[model samples]
Target: MEEQAKQKLKNYVLWLLSRQEYSRRDLTFKLQKKEASPEYIESLLDWCESLNYIDETRYCEGFIRRHLAKNHGYARIKSEAGAKGIDKTLLAFQIEEMEIDWFQLARTAYIKKFSNITDTPDYKQKAKIVRYLMYRGFNYEQIEFAYTHNQS
Candidate 1:
């Protein structure tokens, strides 16, 4: 490839990364979609990794930060990272280190979707709150905590 073409590919990769953090595999696939060859792709990835331009660990941490702040759970974040080709070990470590307030998060989601859960005594109403929290990727512990506290 010509100098300009290589530079173009490099610039494109930088541009993509500047917008958002991407998994190593995700970024590779994205660059491939732009017609960058395998050899060039690998070389570029090597450069990026060495330069600290794309760190999967940092990406995972950032992803965790964003998702957790958005009130997501371990299972959901883990699955999403796996789908992007992140290693299970790394994902697990991220989850372990995570300081998620499950009850507060669950309560937030429950309230956002269904207000005044404690006021409703009907089984169906309580079930709706449970279902809503579950759908938002909250675990049993968090759901129970939120529901019980809300009832009080």
Candidate 2:
């Protein structure tokens, strides 16, 4: 019976993986939702990892690439990766290897969102844009750099 349950869970996981990349935690949560035995879930996760069917590094790289293409900053990327159960050490290494340009990304994001502006915005407008950029995960330095250099 336990073996049957584990096999069912494994099939479910494979189906999910076929749709998109899932972090180990994400898979565990899904199994738990399906009432899979915790012990079996852990063992199954281990088996999946051993098979390289669930590579966190590959997931992280693809995640960062997609988010970066959408112009998300480092902070946002880090936070999202952490929340998705990526190992912090691995995430840090991956981020470093990616060699992202936060400042340039911030500028591009700002420009993409507020491209109609032709002059330096007033204090209120500046504040609004700053808040938007900050919410988009850029640090203060990067946002300021974007604002100062990109504003015509």
Query: What are the models' TM-scores?
Result: 0.88, 0.90
Tens digits of lDDT, candidate 2, 21-90: 8888889999999998788888888998999889989988888888899888888888988787788888
Maximum-TM-score candidate: 2
Highest lDDT: give the candidate number: 2
**Distance from true location, Cα of 129 in model 1, Å:** 1.4
- Whole-model lDDT, candidate 2? 0.86
- Candidate 1 scores a C-alpha RMSD against the true structure in Å of 1.9
